[model samples]
Target: MARRATVYQVAERAGVSIATVSYTFRQPQRVRPETRELVLQAARALGYVPSGNARGLAKGRSQVLGLYAFDMFLPCDLSAPEVGLDDLVAQELDRLGDVRRFPLYVDEIQRGFELEARRLGRSVMLGSGTSRDSLGSIDLAGSVDGLAIFPGGAARDLLEHVGRGVPVVIFSSPPMHDPLHHITVANESAVRELVDHLVEQHGHRSLAFLGELAAPDIGARFTGFQGALAAHGLPVPEEPFDSTVLTEDSLRTLRAAIASGDVPDALVCATDQLALTVVDLLARHGLRVPEDVAVTGFDGIIAGRLSDPTLTTVRQPFVSMGRLAVRILTDTARGLAHPTSYVLPTRLVIGRSCGCS
Candidate 1:
């Protein structure tokens, strides 16, 4: 093989000090973009190769990020079965080990991360958000220069403290405090779109919404559902069924309401799981889905596809959300100024359940 080029040669070709060259490749988050570009150009021209040993010695640190994601692993564990648990856990662990691993999940986002990491010559270490008590001792203490946190966990306070020490980006909705970055979907608008599709296209006027109404995101969804009804000039029915759970008691209550001849023409669930449960309950009551009462749900989960009369839903760009979180965190790591909240786009996925086009 040809003689390997040295960092000294690369620095000389780039017309920058050895420190700048090292920061450009090793600790890129600490260097300016223009300087990084110059160093990369010099390396390419001089046929210089990056040596891990040289990079570590120059930067005084490893080029890796501390990433935390509770979203994927949480839902997967809840939805997937015990038999497949081992495989799912392995896949999750693999996600953490992958060098380009931060919080990025979508395809385009992954591509962007790969490009940035290559240009910066850095790697990432993925970690799950701690279960509150173990938050501090969970290796986020100074192992990495940056952090990416998913929503719906007790580590918020811990992350807040970590944010003070390093750049932190939270991938969640309902915007957090300033200086901390967040990436989330347009939850309300997407729910409105689904509700409108049901009412206008599918002829559903009387409707009921089921799910945890206490959640901020879910509350927004309910507002959207009600707003759609008002916009359509549809009267809000008296005592629309509000269900906390899809257990036998709640399902029986719905069945009784239907039997009493005051059933909602449509039922919009807060999640795919709730939607599936409602569908099963309605069937048990001799109500044919869509033919008797239409249904739609939020969160385009895989289970929705398999449910009878495949569920119509609002697709909450989970993958994109993951990727956006990664981008924001990396940006913060590099000392770039970004907003506290970034609302991404969401879309409606029509299915047989909605009885619409």
Candidate 2:
């Protein structure tokens, strides 16, 4: 039998480091194009067969990146208020069509991760998440090398499972959950910008945040709002000024604020969907937007533009986030030093809702 060619043999023949050879095969971006091509040509010339089995044995899985939502429903419907973050993800996916070819699949929890297994070409698989409960779908992830999860209530369970060997990256707004890589937004800066826009540019002193206060984002945004109020010498209320941390409760809190005459001149929502809902709800109460209560939302989505008065918001760049997740997962699979955390910037988009140009 011919001697089995090691990665070292491939590296020597291709005139590249073992890392370059690995990068050439698994993550082409890390290796220079010319070097990657040379390595590939040398691999072919040596009649070297890259053994998926051997590779799996060496790394414990193929170069499959797993992405999961905590719930299967997040993929198909974003309007469901209980899972508003899913709406943010939906907007992000819309923009991610061109970055890389690694296909994405949403797990239904019915079949094994069949959709992902077939579409991925040494690719990344996004799962709903293991936050609320074990995705039982994890059984299908034996072929995945790493996972990017949007954590929920059952995050700890999922974290424990991924600890079984697979590297885990958490896509969230955070202070870095230990042992899990995080990709977050500049939540504080973005929220501050929005508050500044609402208070300074729009000249609205009375403001409200429509979101779940339990979510970490709530604290960051609240802090920003308070900071803006302080900067402008505006009063920061001592009570809950229309804050709801859970998605299911957001509309109710907003509706109650409207009824109680406690509605702010400008309401900044934690998400686009909430802002959209506020628009509809306010209109139902016979109030004219901007003329009555200017509103701002986070996460720029298609629906935001179609609203009666287009929403002004902090666009979280979801597509960019998805693409970044893929890049990180792919690099990690190739044994590269992926950045410990990635925090993307957000932009304040002006629109009629916030009475902006």
Best by lDDT: 1
Q: Summarize candidate 1's per-residue lDDT along 87-153 as a digit string, tens digits.
A: 8778778676442223223333334444555556667666654355446424663666666655444
lDDT of 1 at 24: 77
Alpha carbon deviation, residue 216, candidate 1 (Å): 2.6
Candidate 1: how large is its RMSD? Answer: 9.2
For candidate 2, which ten residues in a row score worst on lDDT?
99-108
* C-alpha lDDT of residue 45 in model 2: 78
Estimate the overall C-alpha local distance difference test score of candidate 1: 0.68
Model 2: CA > 4 A from native: 1-55, 58-60, 72-121, 135-141, 238-240, 245-250
